[model samples]
Target: MVTYFEATLAQLSVHRVGNKGLNEFYSLSDNTLRIEDETLRRLLMQYFLSPFEKAYEVFRFTHSSDDLNLNELFHFSSMIFDDQSAFHNLSGQITKHLFNISNHPKIKSGELYIATFRDIQLEGELVDAIGIFKSETKESYLKVNPEEGGFALSYEEDAINITKLDKGCLIFNSEKEEGYKVIVIDQTNRTDAAYWKDEFLQLKIRNDSFNKTNITLGVCKDFITNKIDEDFEISKADKIDLLNKSMKYFKEKGSFNLDEFSEEVIGNPKAIESFKNFSREYNEEFDAGLDQPFDISGAAVKKQAKVFKSILKLDKNFHIYIHGNKDLIEKGFDEDKSMNFYKVYFKEEQ
Candidate 1:
């Protein structure tokens, strides 16, 4: 549970943007370029406040001389600026645009805060990180008067509401096998989730075994819902029971054997064959494979659980849990012809 500070950006100072650099002071030249491009500005806002969100794990920054990633980043920024040398380049680029934001009609004032972590514990590992956040706040005042004609407006600083996180970015110093991982958040209009994820952070979307398993499970659910199971002449409960068995199989076994799973869960020869064909079609359609051993991800299983429902909701009265013993259940209409009923037979009431 890390806490953050919020204060008015009264002035732009070099001290706020780290001390070691050729450029140390905020000057008129810094105001030469404004953040006019909507896409770039939106990304900046997103990157600035991303670390504060709970979904992401934070880390501490390990900045010093001869940091390669930092150097590469500086080079990247310099290329963007088309400059040979950029002292205090990252902050300069960010702050100048921030200064120009005051001129925009929609944005009047903003809050800029710097975040430095001593160390961050993430997934049982501690790492260094740095973050910056810019939030747009709506400021107002309350008028109070003790005497007549002596009313004074008190600036409601405490009530200042954060309308949105205009821009933010957080950088971690921990070295991954490929590169440093970063998080960026944007609330602006022009860009989407992919723009920040792909273009700015250069993050590779996870398409691993866990993701593939989720997709395959989702395909099975689709097959059941779309009446592809009708060819097996199985009842609705039977269809759900088969799906539940499939889930249980994945949970219990390390590697999924397609033939074995089809035999055990689906049972019927026609249904098993249909399931195999469906699995093949799913693999080919989504660029995934199901033949190999893929360790199931607990997270993926939990996420897909809601989608793989095994309950039959009958009107508003009964929720039939149809995960087992489909043969004991019978579905038909009553003699009145206005009511549908499912007669369930159980050995004992547990």
Candidate 2:
């Protein structure tokens, strides 16, 4: 009765590489993943289609401050929660936000938000937590912050609170003069995180401002000022050749692990072959569209990668056992209606 996330987490262990560390396991929760014996940290980056430009940035998010890589953080927190390690705490505030998201109808692929609930207190007496979330289609319902902290809401009067998390992000809580300070995050561009405002609409950060203009030529501009800059880069012919050559690292050293990591992640060798074949074919097509020595990946490439991620499976024989074999389901499986259990047929020995 192990959930995919639980099973996947059990397989992953924190493996460090000098300064940064990569998650050496499959993240069945968000997406499929694999890492074993090879320079696994590097292998996953390519396998997951984590772009080279954002590589270091994403890498840092895993092992930024100290030795506790992302996996270690999960391993540590999982122990605290009776072995239910579902989320990594972004901060006290971010953790609360994640809690709210643990239950949802549909959080669109690109859709993300941060919200707050002011003057909300839980004395353990209330049947439900304070705060209301009203989606346009459905009536508003009372909810609680998953973790703790952040401005999730602006009551007619006090407190700001945020709930729900999409990725690894920090929620800020600054102190004000009178009682408390203001709470807001700029997410106009993709680099910035998004937050829900009174359940109305979230703001988007403008790419123009975050990108082109800000460069860390002299000093580091952080992710905000350099958002656009991070998204694009200009490379000469030699570097392009190096990248194409470097990619072999994933495919080459990746082979020793072929029998294990890649095999498990892809499930069937045929599927793995298909993925590799397509990667090469599409890589050529993608490169064909680029200009001169400089090149960038278009949305098309990332889209295909997502498609591959979904269909890729680690267990060929894996089955989703609902009420398995409890009853004989006639003509089998339909998600809409629940019928009966399934039965397996076998041949008698002659």
Candidate 3:
């Protein structure tokens, strides 16, 4: 969704932010780094923006007070967007804000990079974007060179691997009022110390086609796997069939209609009604404002399809992958062995 083929890094400021809980302090940069070498600039661009290529889900900054100006990052980013001259100062403020939020003892101190890019291709438009990144993990690299008759080898420790970015976010300057479209990646703090996105960014998933399709598929999966068995005497093969049908529908159709999906995927009247009720309950519980008859996101379908279990494990012996034609596979119990088994029928072998 985001491309940097023609993008150029305009400004870059690096700072060191430490964990407040550990009594560490943050150090601000005196001036923005002027990258003179074109090769290093290109590599840094790749390192910063490459992770966002597959990031399709968009997010917007939100606040508990329902005020955009109240959000610190949003306001600071807006100021920087409005006036590039204030980039260094605003970037320092952003780093200070991050330091203030690093109260958890598990949070690691790292170098924070604030960069501004130009001509970033997002969706179909070329827009400038502000990037914030932090490097938390380090690696060791060995260097070898020709020295006299033999090659000398030396190693360097505590080196930042440009390939593995720890945390990063890109804020495109397209939608200024609505918090500007944002995409983030945080690979380090995935556990309880999830302050990077939740406490620091304060972002909410944009209610777009991607989120709707993702949430809809999640609701269907939960209803079929966990809730349906409670009310209906459905077999595991039937569940797999339903899941397969759901995936097929999403893959085949560009748009999603609840009524059509119910009629096609869920044929039973009572089951369809139960599914609708369960969907409503799920929406209410999670506050997922899913709109009906919305366009289906292929990326979301592709991502959610991975988690839809199509494999049926038979004890510890065989695993039946029910992809199509549930009727071809029959479940039965052997009398002598007293063990349940699955009978699979196939037309040809690959």
The alpha-carbon deviation from the true structure for residue 177 of candidate 3, after best TM-score superposition, in angstroms, is: 2.0
Model 1 backbone overlap count:
16
lDDT of each: 0.53, 0.25, 0.91
Ranking by lDDT: 3, 1, 2
Instruction: Name the runs in model 3 displaced over 4 angstroms.
Output: 285-287
Best by TM-score: 3
Q: Model 2, residue 327: what's the lDDT?
A: 24
Q: Is candidate 2 or candidate 3 better by lDDT?
A: 3
Query: What's the lDDT of the predicted structure labeled candidate 1?
Result: 0.53
- Give the RMSD in angstroms, all C-alphas superposed, for model 1: 10.9
Candidate 2: stretches off by over 4 Å:
1-165, 168-191, 194-236, 254-350
Number of clashing pairs per prediction, in order: 16, 32, 0
Candidate 2: tens digits of C-alpha lDDT, residues 1-350? 00111111112222111101121211113321234555754332222121112211101112233332233322233233333232222122233333343322232222122122122211111111111121111123444444465435422322121232123221112111111111122223232223233111221111121111111110111211232133334222222222222222223331223234335433445544544444345336533211111211232223222322112111465353222221222224557775433343435644
